[model samples]
Target chain A: MKKINFSAGPAILPASVLTQAAAAVENLDGSGLSILEISHRSDAFDAVLVEAEQLVRELLNVGDEYGVLFLSGGASTQFFFTAMNLLNPEETAGYLDTGSWSAKAIKEAKNFGKVNIIASSKESNYDHIPRGYTVPDGLKYVHLTSNNTIFGTQFKEWPETDAPLVADMSSDIFSRRIPLEKFGIIYAGAQKNLGPAGATLVIVRKDLLGKVNRTLPSMLDYRVHIDGGSTYNTPPVYPIYVMMLTLRWIKAQGGLEGMEKHNERKAKLLYEEIDRNPKFRGTVADDFSRSQMNVTFVCTDEADTAAFQAAAEAAGCDGITGHRSVGGFRASIYNSMPYEGVETLVRVMREFE
Target chain B: MKKINFSAGPAILPASVLTQAAAAVENLDGSGLSILEISHRSDAFDAVLVEAEQLVRELLNVGDEYGVLFLSGGASTQFFFTAMNLLNPEETAGYLDTGSWSAKAIKEAKNFGKVNIIASSKESNYDHIPRGYTVPDGLKYVHLTSNNTIFGTQFKEWPETDAPLVADMSSDIFSRRIPLEKFGIIYAGAQKNLGPAGATLVIVRKDLLGKVNRTLPSMLDYRVHIDGGSTYNTPPVYPIYVMMLTLRWIKAQGGLEGMEKHNERKAKLLYEEIDRNPKFRGTVADDFSRSQMNVTFVCTDEADTAAFQAAAEAAGCDGITGHRSVGGFRASIYNSMPYEGVETLVRVMREFE
Candidate 1:
């Protein structure tokens, strides 16, 4: 049976993307060389890089002011790199601490500059997005995680902030459209809604760079990568190539607008089941902040958690176990997760009830 | 005809490894989940990471003192990271400048501390490794590029020093047995002999860390990664998985000793042809310093370069063109290049002559 993979990140990719990527690993588009063996400097891979960048622009409605870079080190590296490039020691940056990833970003930013926790839901176990915080003047940028993969919460509405918004949208990027002009930077690891792991997708507004006083390392500097066309060094080639294919897949599925609707339908189906079924309850406190990507819930009877998990696994649902910090279940239905997979989970819940 | 790929790093991998990787991409070990979709936290990938580290220990004879980490950002990132963790701003490190990569490393290292160029072959176009340079006293570490990919030169002997030797063995790692005891750090990007691009193999001495006073970011700190077991963040999953498979293949072919013999055979076959054939001349000035992995050579008649390149391509020899800095040919016969591939190249050289 085809396993319904609900892995939070490094989660399910489109079946067709996997099939095409598999073939390319052996022989990329009949080029007689495995994608694994091709040089990043080769004309063939240059085309792949170019097309992938183009697809991001088309899908995200990006402009000339922003540079699209497929980098390495995942979002974890970006946690420091963004601050290293954007924030100075004397400068202060405001961050909205929604969940685990947000807290991490804040921690790293403190290494480079002053980080103010504008608002935080951590006191409440991050079950809801904190609201009604004042956006302080003279802040370099306002940072936030668009979605909390662990807490199963998301920023349904953008915080009204005049500071150029820098987001670590590791889990929710490309799933929906956003006001691109409102942000100075948007970075994500390529495990969710993108391709596989390794490649980090960074879209940075060019003007915001070169303003920081610190001398940045070449790999961490956005300008060096932008100038090198993301070939600054041998990029994560295989991941970028897979990302190009995934982006091509995204374009074919009608871009982000299409992805938003597709994701919404799946989220609605699963969330309704969690609410309606007495056997299960949603983890997040607020309905508005509930994530469309990762649907988290727990059994009404805590002891029944293990039995329900075994039942889900038997029905081909895998990686549904929640994070250790937040114990329950989290069904991560990213862009490629078919609606039928969610339907199967809903049916399993109904049967269990 | 199957093309004989000889592109430098992001070079060839074993054909069987590629085949296995392709299959796993579709469904990993019959788990009904594509390897691309599997979580980094899953037991499936944990096993992959554990086995890969074990294989490194077995192959390199790594002791408990050394901590093997599969990191991201490639060798380019490590150029600064090593210096950041090892050298205080007051400290000085010695570096051997051999080629482009070495020079780049030197440039990055200077940002962290005082870097002394212990020896350099740059004046002579780096055609030979510098010899007889005194290892200055009180140096934090003596860094060197084990193999100069662009200039086709390699260190025939290690410099006599008590300072822990740090090597960027990007191209020649795993091609032969090394003096692992002398080195404090050994890092290689996983494009050449390992598997693919994205994941970087970092082997660091545990005792050498935490001595530096600099407050290290979580991503750059070697100790943090060691504690996380290379799972500090989501590593380049697919590349690490492919590397594990490649390492497994290496063991099957009889470890590092077996690889050294295989590489020597390939190198001897082509180097002999270059020396005897009037049409070709080896690039390295010192015969002993010539790299076994990248056998770079030039045509005696410069005008014949274009015609020879075209003819080789027609005969299914791809990626033979040399680095743009040094125009000629570079047959990068990394571990995976079959012995038959070299024989075919020899036949091509004879035909061209």
Candidate 2:
């Protein structure tokens, strides 16, 4: 069977991207060498880095003031490095606790500086994005997560803050148009919409750096990577190459505007079935806060869970099982997720009902 | 013509391993999903992680007292994380300054505790490993680099110390048998002999941890990785998978003992040519300190450098040009570097003469 993939992150990639990446793993750009064996400083990889960075700027309409870094360590490490580079020991950083990832970022930030919880949806079980949180003055930066993969909520609107905005857009980056001027730093782990698992993409406005009062470790310093052009250490060459191919795929699919339309259509189709079908119910309370990337819901009858899963499996739906923390179903419809896959799941839901 | 790769770390991989890795990128073990798309928590990846860790234990003869972690951010990150987890603020850690990587390690260690330089070869321009330095008592741990990639020197013998020994074996790991009991921690970035870039192999004795006074960041803490089985977050999935394949290949080639014999042969052949050829001379002064991984030399006439490079290129030799810091030639013959490739370079050198 041709499985319709719905993995949350390290999720589905475009078929063509996979084909090209597989070929590159054997021989990159006709060099008679695998991309796996090429030096990070090689001209071929340098060209890959250039094109990847260029695509980030062009797709997001970013200005020259921003620097795009392809760094190792997933967003989990960024939970620390972001604060280590941006927040001084004395200054306060505001973090909105939306879900698990935001909470992790808050914990790591506290080790560096004073972290204030501007707002948290934890009391409500994070089914919706917290709103009306006042952004206090004299803060180093305000951190927010654009999409919560686990809780199935997203920030539909950016919080108004005078402090420079720093967002972990791990799940929804490149899926929709991002306003580049409003943030100090926008970072994402590359597995979701970017490419694969090893590389994290950090897009920071150059002016926001060099302001932190601590003497940073050389590898932890954003300025070092920006200066070295993301080749500070041997980079994750294969992941970065795959990322470049992904961005190229995104551009061919009509950039973020076209991606937004595709994602919304999939989300709408799946969500409508959840609302209409008696056997299924949407997990998130607020419609506006529901994520377009991850659609979370549950079987109406707990006893029918097994049967529903079997039906979905028989229909070639893969990774529809919900996160372990949340006992239900989640169909992650990222940029590369075809409309047909969502339709297939909707049919499963209807037939199961 | 098929080119021979001689690039330093991020060097060549075995052809059979490359074939399997390429196929895995398309569909890992017939999962009908690209390895790039599978979740790190999936059964297939869990099996991969288990097998990879098992292979490391089997090949290195690591006891149960040690923990194997596949980490990210490369060895550059470990240069700091090792100190953060093992060194206390008041105590001193002894560092052996071997070359660029060792110097970088020392600089990062100073941030956490007092760093003492017990031995240094920087005075000799790192042409040979420094000996006769006392391993003073009451030190937190003694640190050294096993192989100097840039300077072409290596530790022919380890310095005796009562304190736990930590070695950065980034360039020489798995190419030879290691005495697991002599060291508290052994770390290597997986680009040279291990696999590709993106993953770092860290093997640490469990007892050596939990003694540091500082409250380390969770991700930086070695204990966290050990407890979580190196899946603290989504690991570099593809890199780890490839490392497993590389280790499997190593086992097929008769493990570390066989690898050591092969590496010794390649190094002996190239070094002999550098010594005998009228047109070429070795860079390192001490014969005993020369590395088996990287063989560096220079043309006798400085004017012949460009022509020698062109000739090597014409003969299907790639990345023979030396690092820019030291203007000469470096032929990095890693584990997967075939004996035939080394012979080809020797033939090129003789013809050029």
- Scored by lDDT, the top model is 1
TM-scores of the models, in the given order?
0.99, 0.98
Per residue, candidate 1 scores C-alpha lDDT tens digits across A1-353 of: 88999889898999899999999999988899999999999989999999999999999989999999999999998999999999999999999999999999999999999998999999999999887888889899999999999999998888787899999898999998999989999999999989999999999999999998888889889999999999999999999998999999988998999999999999999999999999999999989889999999999999999999999999999999998778999999999999999999898999899
Candidate closest to the true structure, highest DockQ? 1
Best by TM-score, which number?
A: 1
Q: Clashing residue pairs, candidate 2? A: none
Clashes within 3 Å, all models in order: 0, 0
Give the CAPRI class of candidate 1. high
Q: Which stretches of candidate 2 lie over 4 Å from their true place?
A: none
Q: For residues A236-311, what per-residue lDDT tens digits would candidate 2 score against the true structure?
A: 9889999999999999999999999999898999999999999889889899899999999988888989899999
Q: Over the true interface residues, superposed, what is the Cα RMSD of model 2?
A: 1.0
Residues B1-353, candidate 2: write the lDDT tens digits.
65799999799999999999999998888888999999999899999999999999999999899999999888898898899898888989999998999999999999999999998988888888887889989998899999999988888788888888899999999888877788999999999989999999999999989998766778889999999999888899999999999999999999999999999999999999999999999988789899999888999998999999999989888998888756699999999999999999999999988
- Evaluated on chain A only, model 2 obtains a TM-score of 0.98
